[model samples]
Target: MKQLLEILGFIALVQGVAGLVHEFTDWDWGFVQRLDVLDGYEVYASVALLVLGCALLAAAESRASR
Candidate 1:
């Protein structure tokens, strides 16, 4: 369970970082306009997932430590 949570957290963290970069650096969004809404949503989702995954990982780790 701990390992699973850690893996999920890592995945979410990485994905969130990617989404954040995409939101900030992607050029298409600046010009295309549609990328704005799409990337914004992706960023939000990724951030939420990241938080949830990290929480799960922490809970699992705490349980394992016990």
Candidate 2:
């Protein structure tokens, strides 16, 4: 479970980074402007996933330590 969570976190982080790249390359709107409606969503979701995954991994680790 811990390993799974870690993997998920890594995936999320990578996806978030990709989203950021997409947003940066998008010229339809200026940076920090309307980005949230576009690729920014990916960033947000991926960040959330990463945080959740990390937390899960931490919990698993703690449990294993017991």
Top-scoring candidate (lDDT): 1
Encode model 2's per-residue lDDT on 1-66: one tens digit a residue: 667766665665555555456556753422323444644365565456556656766776786776
Query: What's the TM-score of every candidate structure?
Result: 0.66, 0.47
Model 1, range 1-66, lDDT digits (tens) per residue?
778878877776766666666667873322222444655477676577668767877877897988
Residue 34 shift from truth in candidate 1, angstroms? 13
- Model 2: residue 45 alpha-carbon error in angstroms: 4.2
Scored by lDDT, model 1 comes in at 0.66
Model 2 C-alpha RMSD to native: 6.4
Residue pairs of candidate 2 with colliding backbone atoms? none
lDDT of each: 0.66, 0.56
